[model samples]
Target: MSSIASQSRSGPRRGRPRDPKTRRRILAAASALLNEGGIGAVTMEAIAERAGVGKPTVYRQWPNAPAVAMAAFLESTRPLAPAARGGRVLEALRIHLRKVAETFATRAGRNTALMIAAAQNDSELAKVFRNHFIMKSREIGRTLLDRAIASRQLRSDLDIEAALDLLYAPLYFRLLIGHGPLDAHFTDAIIDAALGGLKRRRRT
Candidate 1:
């Protein structure tokens, strides 16, 4: 018999079972609140009311409002896969940027911006944002950079930290400035300009 069958026959299941549906409902309620009134709108009481659960339930799951907001933000803005792999690092970077642009163009984008502003004043929120969001983006960039280095597509001497900044700083600038909408063409340009220097080749 399968392990599941064996466990069933042995006795009742053990350990704390996770209710995925309940979690999804909570996240959905949080998202709706954020969409309606930004981060400030996502109170434990509000989420409980929206999700048809008690305030204690929301509090039990997440310690604070920022924690819940961070969870909701992550749920809404889960990063997409690299555009291409195995070859064409530049192409992959471009695709990734385009996806980011699209994400920032929606209601989630506004909430993200507000959350960032709030995080500026809240150290705990700042930590959550860095750990949950910024670090993930850095990890993806680092992986791509590592692959490029191994392939001799980019210079081994390049600083991965600085390289990540060069690639992402412009995107943040554009978003914060409201300069223009993030688009394929804009991302393509950023990739082209950045790869020109980072790429392992002599310009002549």
Candidate 2:
């Protein structure tokens, strides 16, 4: 769940051995702090206190606050199931978007927003975030688009990256700008709008 890129260090590592429960608590605590106060508020000592674990416990898993926040952000986005193949493309898309919408409304979601912001200046962190979170989401979208194209239901010439942009870019846009609701209906509407153009035109 830790998404922060690891750093090479030249000394004995300090921290307790990893435990799943402890790790979950720490992530949950990190998420709460992140949601309540943004990234600036998540200190190592604060996470330790919130998670009810020693500072060493947190250090064992994450070297810094960004690391903790990244891990929590990954956990938040991790629950979404990829769009199922062989299902109707639109419905599958709707479900995928719905899960994304639900997660986007949370603190973990907000932490992810922070991750995006942090990555703007931190190239190393940007690489890690793209490799794990963004890459996985893109892969999922790619698979679904491939199936859609093969089914003759969508245009064969569809641009994979652009298609995904149509599906996801708007959601992230709304999340950042707060111009509209990220609700279930909004997800459905976006899917409908994208498919309207993505679908193959009927021949007369």
Candidate 3:
């Protein structure tokens, strides 16, 4: 090896090095506690203990319980599979909605429930939740919808905003209102009804 090659191999590396799975374990620990007992249960000390890491480790990643909960909540609801190009939009929509349903039905659901209630009274948390969760989720849905519209799979003139609301609002409604089930059958119904309206009409 040349002198320059040796020097290139030895220069200081950038950013915090990935610890393989330590950080994931910490986030997992944080999420576990948050899911099981809500925000009150997710302390830095408890997270460190559960993750089998030092307090400094947990603190190094997240400053507070809310921060951890926010990260975990976002992670739990992250898009499962974004629709591929030239793929079936309806199936992709169903897959994404199914994950939403699953998350709302799980322990992380506990954290979401508290966030919803607290958001009503706590302005700051509400803003954080809206920015991180609501906005991000919609962006995901919009990507799928945009692809369909671009490919002429759906009508070009459709109202994307109202269409998005119709696609996702019902799931949240079921979660908060307890009016009905958020099952696969329900998911199918949502997919069909929403797509039915968006589909481009065939010329006679």
Which candidate leads the pack in TM-score? 2
lDDT of 3 by residue, 1-204 (tens): 222212122221344543637767876888888867787788888888998988766555555556666666665565555556457875676777777777777767646666667657555555655665666777888888888898788899989999889988888778777677767778778889888788999899
Between 2 and 3, whose TM-score is larger?
2
Task: Give a tens-digit lDDT track for model 1, residues 104-139.
Answer: 667867577667775676666656556656667767
Candidate order by TM-score, highest to lowest? 2, 1, 3
Error of 3 at 136 (Å): 2.6
**Candidate 2: misplaced stretches above 4 Å?**
1-16, 82-86
Q: How accurate is candidate 3 locally (lDDT)?
A: 0.70
Off by over 4 Å in 3: 1-25, 52-63, 83-86, 119-121, 202-204
Q: Provide the overall lDDT of each model, using Cα atoms, as 2-decimal numbers.
A: 0.71, 0.74, 0.70
C-alpha RMSD by candidate, in order? 7.6, 3.7, 8.6
TM-score for all models, in order of appearance: 0.80, 0.81, 0.71
TM-score of 1: 0.80
Winner on lDDT between 2 and 3 is: 2
Q: Sort the predicted structures by lDDT, highest score first.
A: 2, 1, 3
lDDT of 2 at 69: 77
For residues 26-139, what per-residue lDDT tens digits would candidate 2 score against the true structure? 889988888888877889999999999888767766667777777677666664556466668656767877877787777667567766676587666656666766667667
